[model samples]
Target: MHKHSYIFITFLSIIGLLVSSCQQQTAQSDEPQQTATPKDSTEQLVLLLSPDQMKTIDLDTTSLKQTTIRKNMLLMGKVSVSPTHLTSLSSVVGGHIKTLHIIPGQRFSKGQVLATIADMQVIQLQQDYLTAKADWTSVKENFERQQTLNAQQATSDKNLQLARAEFQKLNATVHALEQKLRLLHIDPTTLQADNIRQTIQIYAPFSGTVNKVFVNTGQYVTPTDIICELIDPRGFILQLNTFEKNLPGLQNGQKIAAYTNDNPKAKSTATIINRVSSLDDDGAGIIYATLDQPNPTWVTGTYVNADVAVNNYIVNSLPQRSVVSFENKQYVFVKTGESSFQLHAVDIGESSDGRVEIRNPAQLADMPIVQKGAYDLLMAMKNKPEE
Candidate 1:
């Protein structure tokens, strides 16, 4: 009986030790859980501040100053042939192209021969013209003699009148022959029976580079056929298309800067020489803006960008972050005084870079606008009531 009692006591002592260890572990777990509750509560109670409340917290202000403002509008444009420099060459007579005196890209002066055309019809016309000139000369001599004889009564009045009429008719025939020869590309002074030519020489009407040559040696050509195209490099214009909404600010003589994609660093100032009133079929519009100077780097058909200056308006300007939008309305926090802020409505205008035009009379010129810590102040103002 004594041995069994001793064994029972040993078992009870072991159970008591295990229970104490379990209680110590439970207390340790509860202590950390209790500390975490306060931390979670503090995290949930976040504060949000309005613009006015933000301005009340140690805000800064500055005096406003008047400054010149300029408005700039950017537009895309392209290089095009100036209307003044574009010319088309057409053949005056139908014939086989005998020879091309000038190739494409060759420069020629006014009245210079560019090509020659050989036509059977031109040969016949030249022959007729030569014969008419000879006949007209003979008739003129006879008429002069008849006039002298009529004054002396050496010849009958009827005979004198007949000679005079014949002379006038021959003169008209000579004029017609000259015109026909000219149309056939024959110089009147170079016309003679032995020197008569069938090939008509086409002359350059203007001094410019030949941009296009449509005919080769031995090619057949007609009077209506386009022979060549002349382009004067000296005459160049920048053609730019702009939006219709920007039309009101655009006018002839307005200054603009043009730059090309290839040479962006090189800029040229041009004037608005023309504006088209029509809009394109698409909702997108177009306006013609011409440049003042001819830039050699500006190639025809190359695209460019243009910046045009428009009218300037006065407004209170501030950093872009100073004003924030909420619920479709714009608001700015104005510093009423030290440790005070008031919400003010403002009309905004043109914005560029980091600055925005603020149209408000609340004297924002010298006031310190919340630039860096606006969002933080906003949160503070929202939680001020709860605090």
Candidate 2:
């Protein structure tokens, strides 16, 4: 019995020791863990370059300065042919497209034959013109003879009047046919018996490049069908849409920097002609601007970006090179120490004369910035790691 009691006491002591160890482990795990210290503000975004490295890259630094900058309003615009220079081509009479002499982008002069259309109606028109001409000639001769006879008292007045009436009716018919032939671009004088044409020719009314061709050969079209479009490249206009609040600063002859979205760097100059007073359905106002010099490369309806010179004002500004674009956001490298710079986010406003306006200048108050080699620094800070 004592041997059993001793064994029981030993087992109880072992259980108590195991439970105490487990409780200690659980208490340790439940306690709060300490977090690592965050990186210093300068070290987080700074690039520490050696003296030789800075010289090799030609780094430049400049402080902010208060200067007058011409403010520009950036706007989205579209390229279009001036309303006076646009034209739509279609046949006055419906028929199949018989022949096409030009394609889109081909240049043609005024009065040039563009295409030909064929139909039985066109042929019938020529036949009627010829028949009327022949009948009128015969009747005219008979009437002149009757007039002579009446003057000599050899014919009755009633017979002379009857001949005169018949002659006038034929004359009217001939005149009507002549006008119809003109509308068909056919010369009435050229309507000889053997020279009648079954097809009518359509001529270009003005000189321009073919903008579009809608029909193929042998395709049927009606007078309402838009067969083609033409636009003069010399009359390319920049149509800028802006809010009504921006109207006060716009004026005729104001300068504009315009460029296409496809080639934003190739900027072209334009002059505002007018700011329309009427607002569109979206409450957006339109301003028409003509290119300082027309470009044949500009196509109608191409999206464009433009900057309009609104006015001038004093602001804290810096050289344009001091700012860098990253991930679609503008940033500046601010000098935090002798060899350290932190990437700083900035809100930019108007840019002009190689300078950029800082909208929130207070954020960068009295701090030096990477002026000339900002882009190089941005690349280095983003790619290189700290030692």
Candidate 3:
């Protein structure tokens, strides 16, 4: 019985010792856990682990990378030209279309003849110009002879004055006729009574492609008649329609790859030149870009697609999986201590090609980030209390 009593006393002492150890553990639990900052509201979200735990979690660490990111935009619109590129060519004089040297949709260079007119008026003008010149020569000789006689007192002042007046009038008439001959594409210096012809060729004023032909062979054309409608061959532009939401992404000098629905594989490079401030009824804006090489075969008003890479910039970034969303905010895991990681709120920018941009990279510049096991750390942190 004495032995049994001694054994019971020893069992009570052991139970008291266990109770004291439990009290000490409860006191420590009331204090801060892990070696972290003082912001318990956010800093307390930490994973305090050992090397074995890290290996079990399969964590991989990395640093921020300086790389470029851009958002791709697919724009819808059509290829068009400025009003300055379009022109209406008309016959300079009334005549019959003797011969037509051009057809619709044909490209022409400056000074290339489009048609010729058989106008008898051209021959009459040339003949009148030559006759006026001959009359001017006779009047000039008489004026000189009268001036010489007046200096010698052999002619009256009235006679000298009359000769001068006739000379001036005939010279003015000769000048007017010469200009008329030149207007008919006849160089007055190269024209003579022997070389006078009734045919005058109409030439292109600018290098362009004919859009419409208004006259044919044996057709009568007047001064008000349009010969053809022409368009500048190299003045094609892209008029891409974009919404207000996409305005911030577009800017001058950015490049675009434009293509048509019929031939999407054939891409034409273009550069943005203007962003229209005015909006359409649907609040859509215009993005004007000039093509590097204008395709002459492309008809005006052709519907086209523009692929623009916008807001391109170099920034600190990480793999897409390296960052995770929590509580409606973006965050990343940064290694604060050996086997310890803290959740950091990061400001994200543009994302591209499986990579995400970190706008506030300075916050994590000196810290190692959990690159591969970010989602794992997030799960562990969320369930830490439950465990």
The CA lDDT of each predicted structure is: 0.72, 0.86, 0.86
Off by over 4 Å in 3: 1-55, 58-69, 146-165, 252-255, 261-267, 312-319, 323-372, 375-387
Tens digits of per-residue lDDT for model 1, 1-387: 999999999999999999999999999978854333444543322333456755665544433334335567788868777777887887767899888888876778888999888889888888877788888899999999999999999999999989999999889988987887777667887877888777888887776677888888898988788888887666667777766656767787889898977788888888877776677876455555556666755557778988787765344577667666644666566555545455555687667656677666465656656655444445555556542
Model 3: ten consecutive residues of lowest lDDT: 36-45
Report the C-alpha displacement of residue 35, candidate 3, in angstroms: 50
lDDT of 2: 0.86
Better of 1 and 2 by lDDT: 2
* TM-score of candidate 3 versus the correct structure, residues matched by position: 0.62
Question: Model 2: per-residue lDDT, tens digit, 79-140?
Answer: 98886788889997889889989899898999999999998888898899898898899999
Q: Number of backbone collisions per candidate, in order? A: 18, 0, 0
TM-score of each: 0.62, 0.58, 0.62
Off by over 4 Å in 1: 1-68, 82-85, 101-113, 180-185, 265-269, 280-283, 291-293, 311-387
Q: Compose the digit string of candidate 3's lDDT tens values, residues 13-85.
A: 9999999999999999999878855645655567787666677887788889998688677999988887778
Cα lDDT for residue 26, model 3?
97
Better of 2 and 3 by TM-score: 3
Evaluation by lDDT, superior candidate among 2 and 3: 2
